[model samples]
Target: MRRHTIRPLAALAATGALALTGCAADDGTAGEGTSPGDGGRTLHAQRVMQLTQVHPQTGMTLLEGPTFDEEGRLLVVDVTAPAGEPKVIRVDLDEETAQPLHTDDRGAYTSAQFSPYDGRLYLTDFAGGAVVSLAPDGGDPHTFFSGDVDGAPMNPDDLAFDPEGNLYLSDSRGMREGEPLGRVVRIDRDGEEATVLADGLAATNGISFDAGYDGLWISELLENRISYLHLDAEGGVASRHTAVHVDGGIAQTDSIAVDADGNLYQALHGRPAMLVYSPHGEHLATVEIPAGHQGLESATNVAIVPGGTTAYLTVSGPAGGYLYSFEALAEGTRQSNGG
Candidate 1:
């Protein structure tokens, strides 16, 4: 597996148009953050300064979903422009290079994760309204799940599995205006059954679990809120509740990541910041993004390096994107259900 250290920067100063402030190396005391706790003082994140631009400035690939393969390589989807074709690219951190993987026909990929049960990459094929799997080397792309369960199209967007080896998916009708129809769906660990866990969601974009697996978190884009669902032992939603609601400012949250301390990092797609929340859903901090793809305010997803000390983010638009790594204020819990 590949290992990476944060490439050195002269200082943590904001470069160019990023304009980052109020965050720098502190005494590490700014965070009296507890270990795996459910409460704490409103903590500030150490400014997420860019590690390096893994791509060029005038780029042309809109990036989605960040997943790390078993080899510790970063994988992301390119919702390619013009025809909306989808592709996958593997980024070698040690070499600081990206190589497009050869797939027979990936179609439209929106998000992906490495499954712990099978150790393969599972992805959302948006155009086909299905989920597909691929070998870690990006070979043998095949359909994993597709079609309807309760009459409507699955229209899977983003996905996450649980500690029990069960799978979860978000069926966002579309990221459209006005009230939208969306829901969270689940697949049993045996992959033999499908169930809709919750409904009436709007633009459900991202889903995840807390450090302790106590709650399942989802970002409803059009609804501008992150909902937490209490899951039954088999990984079905027993109860659902709102974790955080964005009343104003960058309400279209596209994705999220949680650290080992239960700190949630949300990707605000319409702005240049990472929204932070406490375990109990209280707003805590904001990490400024220096810039976006060709001025497009879309921060896609975040993943941590194996050592847990750094976080890598995929942020970009059709004009191009960059993989940025930064020192995190807290350590992260690796996906127990995803290899």
Candidate 2:
């Protein structure tokens, strides 16, 4: 985890507001800009909102993992610090007000999700190797999972839940030593123990179930690819295959979100944009921030809004990044069609 003192909220807000203003000016539009795509394609983004800075004071930061709550509010984790405390924040989309939901001194919170079934927030702690469950009203947080589950060392990174209430966690085992492999662990509602569902992956960072809950999609960050694992009758992986392969040395995928139409969006760490792929793994397009934009230094995580027309991306940086909003384009809609 990275370390930095929390600044005053007012200061952060001012900085973010200024950054958004600058971005809007550079694009020559109040709410839209053009983005580049592969094979000379182009995408257009109509900016719905721009959150420039995230901090306890500013109420947003380089957002790590983001998801929508039952009431449609956006929840995101802050992972700006390489060490020390981190925060989880909730942004009221209608009001545009960000409020700190939870804070932990153990380490940076990397990813987060809101369970519609139970209305609890599940967050992953990277350095601390734990999964925390917070109450919906911002009550005390409790540990859902910790290090060394079932005697196997765990470096828990990201997670997703199925309709049956089973939580699937991604453990990037042994990452710091440069030999990080991937494993998927399933924790039932009873909290009895952790069970490894899949193992020996090349750096898995994100996982999400298909809308039908019959298949799982995982992001292989180091390999710059996505894989689909077919689930068997017991809800375990029966077989797996590569779904997509990203080119151009932009392999550090951090988080992923799926829309109603089955389109997939991936947050590319170290790259300045998000990659969009069709369900068949074809590279559909790329979404980029305007060149002079200040908020998007490193696009890390993304969450599709409930209606599927908006995507919120977390930008990682020292000065704190923003929770940027981009309108989702319709299927088969070319960039020339206002994206």
Candidate 3:
């Protein structure tokens, strides 16, 4: 297990004060932020798909999860799509086309992941408070986990699976107004058992394992903080600490992906960009849309395909939903594949 250490206040300033320009110094020299426009080594993401008409009931769309199936096709979910509209979409990168994979009136899936153990797709339903599963072909849909854990209702938002195939979920209950009812849950490989690994979080939105699988990185939307939970041999949290905390920003930290080199790619909710940070919380780079494409500001999640540095981000807002691509900091691993 890696030991935790407190970073200097300058490093904290580099992370919290997002307006400053330049990369963070490992020696705590305090330079921070990339340039406002596209110059400061900003990776201008290219659009891959257009989902302008996905949501009929609400003109606005919210694309949350972006994961690659075993066959390397991109899969994402439309959280704002009403009943009778397609919620799950599969994108073919080679063809640059998207098609609906699943639609159900009872589901408001916020994230989708392909489980490593069963080789099936699993989705987290935020509104329905359940985890659902299906084959990659979108057949034989089944509820993987539901109801309550520890006698408390849960709103499952995002999920991750450990190397052993155990599932970890982020329960985003009571997070809209910053309520502290959020929780982290763990389920067995077969989905027959569940446990509340941690609780009392304010809008636990995204969950992902680190490069080493030694811990988990959790993003809290309301607080704009990333908490690292060091895990023991049994996948239990042994300790906790804030790894990244950005203060006074309209951008809410949403979904995150970890590279094989331990760098973190964090998607910003209100801003059309992704923040790259080192494992020690050093600000690395800001991947954003080009200057003219400002309409795509509601970036939500990121998915880096396994064994490669190519990464895709999910964004939605006035221009509807979009899939953007950029080069990742390092080669993607199992930790980067989902949620």
| Top candidate by lDDT | 3
Error of 2 at 222 (Å): 1.6
lDDT of 1 by residue, 1-339 (tens): 111211101011112121111112222222323323333233323322222232332124446777777787778776432231327777777766677663434355668887768877888866567888888888887778888878977667778877555778877664234445678889875667889888878767778888888777888776678899998776777888887886436336777777778777787665544666777777666554442124434556777665575777665543245665555557766541111
Supply candidate 3's per-residue lDDT for 320: 67
Q: Per model, how many backbone clashes are there?
A: 2, 12, 0
> What TM-score should be assigned to candidate 2?
0.80
Provide the lowest-lDDT 10-residue window in model 2: 330-339
Positional deviation of residue 110's Cα in model 3 after best superposition, in angstroms: 0.8
TM-score of 1: 0.77
Estimate TM-scores for all models. Answer: 0.77, 0.80, 0.86
User: Could you tell me how far off, in angstroms, the CA of residue 180 lies in candidate 3 after the best superposition?
Assistant: 1.4
**Candidate 2 lDDT tens digits, 1-339:** 222433211122223321210122233232433334454233433344444444443233556777776677777776643223337677887776777677655645667776646768777766566878889766778987776776766656778877666778777653334554568888775556678888777667768776566777787766777888899987788998888887737337666766666667776766667777788877766777655564345677677655446666666554455656566653211110100
The 0-to-1 C-alpha lDDT of every candidate, in the order given, reads: 0.62, 0.62, 0.76
Off by over 4 Å in 1: 1-60, 81-86, 104-106, 174-179, 247-251, 291-294, 336-339
Candidate 3 pairs with clashing backbones: none
